[model samples]
Target: MTSQNQTFERLCRTGTSLSVHSTYEIGGEARHLALPHTIEEVSTMLEGATSKGLDPFLFGMGSNTLFPDRPSDDMLFFSLKEHIEFKLLPGRLFVSAGTPMTLLALFGLYTGIPSFDFMFLLPGTLGAGVYMNAKYFSHQISDVLETAYVIDKEHPERGLISVPLSGCEYGYKKSVFMRKPWIVVGADLKLPVDPQLTPEQTDELFAKIKSKNLSTSVLPNYFRHYTNELNAAARAGYELRQELLDVITDRGGKKHFDYPSCGSVFKNNYTIGEPMGKLVDRIGLRGTVRGGAMISDHHGNIIQNRGGATAEDVTDLVKLVQEKVEAEFGFVPEPELVIV
Candidate 1:
């Protein structure tokens, strides 16, 4: 066997539960799953998969993805969630794709920079955020991203290719990354001001954050951990920003972490002049259920796995929402949830 094949075999876990990897807490057992901790490992795995004629399905955090109930045996599922890294540079911050988006908020809090406050409590990792142009109200990942480093999926050996902010072609919940066969590895974020700490201190702070066991995909656990971090920072006299505190209030009020969900299931139709949640509410579809999945009563845009929900259950509800809304509103809402 080739060294890359051996390395990939060592990384692969057989009969892994996809449920634990997704915030939605659905999906059945996957035949092969791998979590690569470095870019080289990722390349090795991809090369090995190519040699085996196995299609690779790449994801990060699984916050917005719906894995199949019966995954194909020929597919190789992999995630970059274990590859978190952060580096402070001259005028920008370099963050690995696996780093949680919410961590950027904590980084900003420590550095006394408010540019990343919008990422507070944002679910998913940096790669997925950049892929989807993740947004919170008016702020989005595109606003802060300066350059994204990616690997062409067709040619992993070609190594990292940099795409500047201007080349990303970002729009509302859209980016050029979405149109290309590329895997985002990391990005350089524009810094609004100099950080409050020295380079060594920054490294120490990131090391501390990385040491914490906060990488679980469970929504409630993820929420409680970050909220506690914010409170701890406030106790340390970091002076919590109102914007950061308000994120807690906003997301908490929406019950975003109360159940297993992939957050908003659909993109809002701009011409409709109303958000997806409001439209769902208007169509009297809030609290609708299919098996164990339910349209969240608190937020109509969300479909939650209340308990023991399967991928089919969630997709059934998604279709129901799409059908009912289209019948009423004369337009079908496009799903934001990525069904794998």
Candidate 2:
């Protein structure tokens, strides 16, 4: 056991506590964490973990996930931070899974493509976005996804097997990746050139996205120059208040992005005239607080970690919202977060 542990540590820098790395700014030490620069290192780590009876968990960007206060020692973590590669061909683009969705979106807009502008303010990497079939109001990642290179950890000898979009049974916030759960190395996306829109329509789409992101207080690329020098104090008062104001302006806003959170804590209503946010707002459960986490008084569907919040605290608060929503409106809400 010691020999294998040593080998795993040698393969990647193993850190003790990683709470600061989380978006929530919570959680305890990771038993082991690896940021492998190359795919070969990733393979070695996975193989070592398996042989040592440790469960391997692939992570990226740490955007859409929340870790436990202290995860099990048996769970080995590795992130593909260094695999972001892109190649532009005539009609398609080959990109590594680690590529930022924002980069792709910006590239699309510059190339006069449609539908990708929605990725302008979206967080997380392209891989996670595809796994979730990321949506932007009306557009979805699956709409342009041609093929993906996925590899089974148990059979790394096959390397990355390319699978077409048809192979992924994609739905609202779901994909076949959830079932088989392989590592996404690269993807091929067909460029948008069909049913081309007029220049006026393209301008309108970009404007619409910019307006939406502004109202939600989600940062846009244009604001990068201004938001770079933020210190500790600037983050709390000015930044947070601006976020709250955005929430106030849009009563049904998705503002988990406003705080350190894994986006929406609960899924929204599918066909109901009013969403889960509207229902929770009706019951006056907004601003509900447990520890450092609170149901945003500005938006109901969001539960924002106000700092120093724990996974247990978030879990308990979820139950609170579920009970209150069911008692008042006779409806139950499912969580979108995958609790570790």
Kindly list the per-residue Cα lDDT of model 1 for residues 199-261, writing each as its tens digit.
788779898767653878899999999999888888889979989989999999999999999
Per-candidate TM equals 0.98, 0.78
Question: All candidates: CA RMSD in angstroms?
Answer: 1.1, 8.4
Please report the TM-score between candidate 2 and the true structure.
0.78
| Tens-place lDDT digits, model 2, residues 242-261 | 33233223322444455666
**lDDT per model, in order?**
0.90, 0.66
The lDDT leader among the candidates is 1
* Pairs in steric clash, model 1: none
TM-score of 1: 0.98
Q: Candidate 2: how many backbone clashes?
A: 1
70, model 1: CA deviation in Å?
0.4
Report the number of backbone clashes for model 1. 0
